[model samples]
Target: MPETLNVQTRDDFGKGAARRIRAEHQIPAVLYGHGMDPLHLTLPGHETALAARNSNALLELVLPGGDSHLALIKEIQRHPLRRTLTHLDLIAVRRGEKVQVDIPVILVGEPTAPAIAVVDAQTLTIEVDALKVPESIEVDVEEKEEGYQLFAGDVKLPAGAELVTEAELLVVAVQLPRVDAELEAAIEENEAAGAELGADAEDSEGESTEESADEE
Candidate 1:
């Protein structure tokens, strides 16, 4: 079920207005989709933030006049340093309607001994019901041996969901971790070069002292 939020229409515009709205513990947002004209709205900051925790959260926005619309978070802008919500762009959606979204990929269980599972793709694009979008899609790596590769097509998606990503796209790879011998050798060579330079500097200083004594 979609989270319900009471929202208000706003006529204010520009950065100044947005800041003022945020100062009042509200979020500024715009809703656009389905060929409708864009609607400027103000949403409660705390409620919207909680719902946004799930990237593909479906929200039912209630207007002051009792009209409501279902919306999907299309984009979010945040403060770079503070990580606070700055603004939002929403797209109107309907329940049961299919929407293309990027769902986070989660790896579950461990691979075979000496083999580690590495995620090649962080998210998978899928077409799923807007109201039924999942929080994440889990990929099983249990007992996977080294050199095992899982592609997007191998992923099992939620019921009725369709994969939009290329089937051949790599999602996870199980491999044995090994150190680079060439890199290690280069580091050792550099250390040896520094030690030789130090010895040459010390010998040069000793000769200078001996010459000073001879002059005496």
Candidate 2:
């Protein structure tokens, strides 16, 4: 699900130091695991960004005093206006350890009919062995007909992963798309008619102004 990462400890904190760290292409983060004191660290910005591109990425951290730890991304903060990472929080995990994480649901295959695939849920939370979390959950809908509905229970789970989501959670459904298309066409036609009416009103006003000038 995730890749390995190596990080170093940071001695500084607060705004000014964070700005300097970001300027140096490093991300400020806090690492906590096994009930140990939180360690403030700075990670290589490019590597961290690449690792975080995946969902529920697992990280292998090499800390100070020659200590090494395993963890997973728990939270991330981004710049409000810029495309930079601001802060990160990581939770410690062990190999084969079970942890709860959200995995994205991916739609696979296509329906035979003109049915629109509706994704009722984008992500599902599950209890998975730390290293066993799937990058994504794939649902094959190939050759499926319209009016087919899929629920959370319908999703195939990988080994050692248990669904923490509610059974009633709707995963996806296939339905006809004609109704939406018809509504969009109607709206476009009405807009065109309104534009034509507005042009006619303007022309009439111009004609009246010309007649008044001629009489004068």
Candidate 3:
């Protein structure tokens, strides 16, 4: 079920008006789509904040005149320092319609012992029912060996969902844990330095031999 919040229509505009709205503990929002004129509105700050926590929050907007509309949060503007909401951009949506959204991908279970699972992509773009958008998707890596990799298309989607991201996009890679990751790096640097020194020494020795041979 979708979250429901009562919102009041607004005629107020501009930064000054928005500041006034925020002072009154409300969020200035714009509701737009489906060929209708944009609806400027104010939503109670507390409720809006809680509902906006989820990326794909499906809100049933209860208007003052007893009409309601289903909307999805498209964008949220926030106060840069304090992290308070400044404005919201909501897009009207219809039930059963497919919408493209980025859903979080979570790793589940442990990969093969001593191997770390590195997630390359944190979220995946998918087309899912507007009303049934997922909160997150899980990828199980239990017993997966080192060198195992998972790509975007390897993810299992909820019913009626379709992948929007490229199929070849890497999602995760399982690799042997570098308990000595730093140590191994240091070793490689030292080996490279040693090789350079050895090469220079050989060149010097060759020059000395050539000088002696020329003198002879």
Candidate 4:
């Protein structure tokens, strides 16, 4: 089900207007798609933030005049320092229609012991029904051994969903963690230097004892 947010149309423009809107705890947004004129609007900051937690969240925008539109979040701009939502660009969508979206790829379960699972691609592009879009796609890596690989085409998708990403793209790989060669060499060099220092200290002590005995 799509999360519904009551939105208000806005005529204000420019940076000053945007700042004022945000000051009032609202987010400025623009909605455009399907041959319709772009609509400038303001959304509730708190509700929108919660709804946007899901990258591919579908939203139902209800206008004050009792009109509603289904929209997909196309772009979100955030403050670089504060990480607050600065602006949003939404695209209108319809139910039963196919839309292309980048869905997150999640790995489930652990790989075989001593092996680590590495993700090559974080998300995959797919075409699926607008209303039936999934939050994320899961790839099972349970008991996968070292050298095991998973490609884009190997990922399972919901019914009616088609992959838009290249089939040969690497999604996940299982491998054994190995130490860097330079680090290993540095460790050996440090051990050798410490051993040489110990030998020199022992020789100095023996010479001091011989000199003391000669003086006595």
**Over 4 Å off in model 4, which ranges?**
179-186, 189-216
Model 2 — TM-score against the truth?
0.82
Error of 2 at 182 (Å): 5.5
Per-residue C-alpha lDDT of model 1 across residues 24-107, encoded as one tens digit per residue: 999999999999999999999999999999888899999999999999998999989988898999999987789999999999
Q: What is the C-alpha RMSD of each candidate to the true structure, in Å?
A: 2.3, 3.6, 5.8, 3.7
Instruction: Give the range of the ten consecutive residues with the poorest summed lDDT in model 3.
Output: 175-184
Per-residue alpha-carbon lDDT of candidate 4 for residues 41-65, written as tens digits (9 for 90 to 100): 9999999999888878899999999
- Per-prediction TM-score, please? 0.90, 0.82, 0.81, 0.86
Deviation from native of the Cα of residue 167 in model 4, angstroms:
0.5
User: Per-residue alpha-carbon lDDT of model 3 for 86-127, expressed as tens digits?
Assistant: 999999999888899899999999998889899999999999
Worst 10 residues of 1 by lDDT: 176-185
Mind giving the per-residue lDDT tens digits that candidate 2 earns over 148-187?
9999987989987899999889999888887888999999
Most TM-score-accurate candidate: 1
lDDT of 3 at 94: 95
Candidate scoring better on TM-score of 2 and 4 = 4
The alpha-carbon deviation from the true structure for residue 177 of candidate 3, after best TM-score superposition, in angstroms, is 4.5
The list of candidate 1 runs beyond 4 A from truth reads: 178-190, 209-216
- Candidate lDDT values, in order: 0.95, 0.87, 0.93, 0.95
